[model samples]
Target: MELSWSTFLLEILNFFVLVWVLKRFLYRPIQSVIARRQQDIDARLAEASAKEAQARRLQDDYEDRLAQWRSEREQSRQALEQELRGEKARREKLLAEDLEQQRARSVAVDSRRQGEQRRQLELQAMEQGSRFAAKLLEQGAGPETEARLLSVFLESLAEMPEARRLQLCAQLRDTPKEAQLQVASAYPLDGGMRNKIEQALTACLGRPVACRFTEQPELIAGVQVSMGAWVMGVNVRDELQGFAHLAPDSVGG
Candidate 1:
């Protein structure tokens, strides 16, 4: 077939028109749809990224809270442990102090008991010793013993203070003028002894006092001169009684 230029040009123009129609109608609309889809995808990706970031932040916050809780728990545990230790220490100190006090009290009680026992033993010893001495003196009572005691008694009266002697003299003088002074002895006194004793009594009284002699075995080897309510004697029994009142050390001495 012979090539026709008009026909060829017409065909080319139809092809261009078809291309233009496709670009304006189908291609443009498809491109717009694709752009919208791309925009949607981009928006979805950005939202996913934001969500992931938020989740990470939440996870970080949760981890921080757990760590803080653990720290607080540890601190509380330490505080409780410290309190228990302090309480234990305080209780131990109190117990120790109480024990010491109890020990001190026990020591004091024991000391006091020991002291009382010692005092009792000393007193018992002193009493026994005094009794033994008195018994010996009583067993040895005789005329010679009575004479010696009488002499000692007279010497003791002579050595008495001037005021005390005068007071005794006055007291004896106040008795009834007819009242006889009695001289008692544990042993029999001979006439010579009686005369000597009478002379001594008269000298002591500063007057001739009425006198009588009597044997009283209870005198325990001593002479007793009695005038009215007054009586003076020196004997083993009186010495033993006086010794009973002495301190243990003095008795031992």
Candidate 2:
């Protein structure tokens, strides 16, 4: 129980020594381990931040590519529509041209058909007129008509060209001895008429020429004079036939 200063001082010194040993060995090594763990955590945080930045850049690039693809697709669709419209317009034009040509051809064919029909109708009318005229002349035949025709015949002979008259005269004179001079008339000639005809023939030939007279009703209303192969006459039948032949040209003109 009495106070001991030496022992007390000794105990205090022992406590200080224990404190120094713990600081130099145990506390310093544990503090170093804690510092290294903190550095590893900081490095991991930095690496995570870098990876996030790279991912953001890749996302932005992908969005840009998608927008470009959409623009290109829209342009292609517009170009295709324009081409289809042009093709349609071209087809319509070709169809319209074909229709016009067909219409023109049909018009031409119709015009030609109408012309042919008109020509045929005109020819038929002309034929009918010719027949009517022939019938009228046949019914009107008479002595007066016959006498007029005979006078015309004589006048025609007198009006003949001088060369033609001379040629006929020469032909008559040089006729074969056995050949007959024939005179044909629509009506029978009386003795006085026959004598008159013989006198005219003799004067034209410059010689007495024997004649044979024949009554032929088909002469219409005229007289025919024949010597060898030569014959001369005028009749309504010849005029009608000439008119018939010329009718087509008259209608066309």
Model 2 misplaced stretches (Cα beyond 4 Å): 1-121, 170-174, 205-207, 246-253
In candidate 1, what are the lDDT values of residues 1-253, reduced to their tens digit? 9999999999999999999999999999999999999999999999999999999999999999999999999999999999999999999999999999999999999988987788788889888887787788778777788778888987876677888879988887667667788888887878887877777777777777777888787668887888767988776566677788875666344
What does candidate 2 score on TM? Answer: 0.48
Residue range 99-141, candidate 2, lDDT tens digits: 9888888888887788667867887799889889878888997
Report per-prediction Cα RMSD to one decimal.
6.0, 9.1
lDDT of 2 at 9: 94
Compute each candidate's TM-score over C-alphas.
0.59, 0.48
Q: What is the lDDT of candidate 2?
A: 0.80
Best by TM-score: 1
